[model samples]
Target: MTNDVIIRRTIEWMEGHLHEEVTAEDIAAQAGFSKFHFHRLFQSAVGMSFTEYLRLRRLTNAALALIHTDERIIDIAMHYCFDSQEVFTRAFKKVYGFPPGQYRRQMMSLMKMKEEKQMEETLKGWFLSGSHPFNYEMGADVETVHQGKQSGYLKSKTVTPAEGEFATMMQQFKADRYRGKRMKLSAFLKTEDVQHMASLWMRVDSASEEVLQFDNMSDRPIQSTSNWNHYTIVLDIPENSAVISFGMILSGSGCIWADSVTFEEVDEKTPTTNLQTEIVMLDEPVNLAFEES
Candidate 1:
């Protein structure tokens, strides 16, 4: 199987068996990779170690349960395989920047206020537009969130024959802080019956809004149907970059859900998926022969 398929299946298995206590060996076996090799590969592609990813996913699910249900804190902890409430609380706080109890209370309060105000579920810091806005719908959704009671969703509302037609929810901001650095954009995505494809995209732009570096996950497109999975795009923001823009895009028919987006500075060791290729300058042209170096 392709590495992408293997990774997807491994993640699916991890999601289904989150409540169980499984080690790296088990996960590697499930993915059909040796434990040692999988460790490196998983960290490289997913931007985190297997253990860390598993723990964070569990904590994320626990966070959801905390907000959605009235279950006891300790019970929720146990359900996700935490050895004790204290351990769970430490992990949860580290990841979410708040204790479980506090997170629950604060999120519940905010959700309540949103509902009371009858606020439309919309992305606040994003600019939503598309080639055919009339043929698509985009908004934040509370009912079908991946975590924390809300997620940004997009769906094609009407059929269109234009191959170039697309709907996108995007955000752009000054690249001052990230200039001359490698940045990774990671998000969890879920899709349904995608007619064309869906992708998480990022681009570094010059002052004139010309794209300098870009990756729309085109090398490995998310097409057809898919369950919730983590996807990421990494790009270098050159010193000349002025803005960074990114978001989810959908072409043709289908729906996509995006949640838990994150950005981080990465070292050069992380391969960039930028569509632009660097040109190599040769000292002299020599290889006119059939076989020569």
Candidate 2:
């Protein structure tokens, strides 16, 4: 089986059995391997360790449950294997931006609004009452669903790609999957004048740090906006990589803004994609008013 397919299946198992006593060994077994061999391969292939993935999985679960159900905090803590409410609260607060209670309250407000909107639409007899508002509210933001009811989270975004001279600007990643292979992005720099760049900022899946930022530094400055503006960043898709997804941010006065960025790796059978969505990148015109001049 391919590494991406393995990791994807592992996540499937995680979603179904998160309430059980899950371990790296358990995941290794689920993914069809022994711990010793699986650990390294899993980390290298998925860009994250099994344990780390479990923690993230737990946090993601807690966050969703906190909003979806009115279950007691202590129950949530216990279910996710936390030793105490305090511990759960601390970790939840650390992962999300707030305590469980606060997050639930906010989620309720958003869900309420969504439901209200849906109610209005349904009353107009557009569809059937079998549909729900909360579904849209939590869809993308929460667990995975094949089809039917989707979570109510906002979906990915889109933007126009920029153009410069190396000859032309092209959509290289385009939602492609590398499987067990490592892929790199390459763009050309005609000169040494760079006020714009490619950066990768993930939620730093470690409990030890609040956030970590990595900007794949290019050797030359974007001396001129005239060249094709070629640039590239190698993505380390290790089995234990901490990235939720990737994004591209653009800086400059080119009237260019990144829309949603997408890489074609959603399915289990391939290694490349022609589709694109963005976790981050310039899609529309950007506002630098907030940046310090």
Candidate 3:
């Protein structure tokens, strides 16, 4: 079902079944793809995960219902499979930046779910004549500064990179597209120089004894030193593949943070490094930015 017609046809079917309890298996069977790969492929093609797409679609439908009918807000929320009005309100506020009551009061005059084209502009940290909530593209100007006990800054790579190189990176690691690809991603960092460098590489080979492999510099002959900068890499993976083991060779008493990372799965042409979202806060994120204090 590589044909866009088939994929879209299935999406069209999904459009009619928002209230039905849906699962990845159902979509995979309908789309003629393995449940494993279908999830990844769907996101890559639609620029959002199947689960996320479905949720957004449901919310979008609810948005319409909220305005068109005289139905109670609680009824609309429950009809959309939300457990309670409070839960629905929280999620609505998170995504739409306004409660459903406010939206209905606005007379459906505004649409908060951004248009697809708006994503590219929003990626550039721009919105309708201004900035929006998420600004990952702003990373283009964000240099990797020294955050730990180190006294100096880091030599960061140019945030913007080639499309092909980035595409390969995205698909090679996207578990949906790359589950079959089975790539090994490794990261390294050093604090010896005033400037710390973070290097990431991947090797995808199925013929070898180890289908997937990962080894940080601390594991090899490379030693963790006072000049050593600790780093971590999280794989945004599906729950079915959650048990994959992480082999590590830690040298000191710091910490190894193990948590799932979430990311956008855009079209085949989109670059993986070009983050589709970034969570901004006063405190730095350890997952995206490593700490060596």
Question: In model 1, which regions exceed 4 Å deviation?
Answer: 1-9, 19-21, 31-49, 62-113, 116-122, 146-149, 159-163, 278-293
* lDDT string, candidate 2, 24-80, tens digits: 778889979898787786665445677766676677677777777889989998998
Worst 10 residues of 1 by lDDT: 114-123
Could you tell me the lDDT of residue 132 within candidate 3?
Answer: 17
Report clash pairs, candidate 3: 191-227, 192-227
For candidate 1, lDDT tens digit of each residue in 235-262? 9999999999899999888899998899
User: All candidates' lDDT scores?
Assistant: 0.84, 0.45, 0.43
Give Cα distance to truth, residue 88, candidate 2, Å: 1.2
The CA lDDT at 112 in model 1 is: 83
CA RMSD for every model?
A: 5.6, 20.2, 21.1
Clashes of 1: 0
Against the true structure, candidate 3 has what lDDT? 0.43
Give a tens-digit lDDT track for model 3, residues 1-293. Answer: 33344555566666667787778788778878787787777755555676776677677667667767789999888888788999989977777677999978774453344243432342232111111112111111111211111111122133432221211011132234545223233222332221221232222233332334332332222222232222332333322332233322222122121111122222334323211235467665465555555
Judging by lDDT against the true structure, name the best candidate. 1
Local error of candidate 2 at residue 92 (angstroms): 0.8
The lDDT ranking, best first, is 1, 2, 3
lDDT over C-alpha atoms for residue 78 of model 2: 92
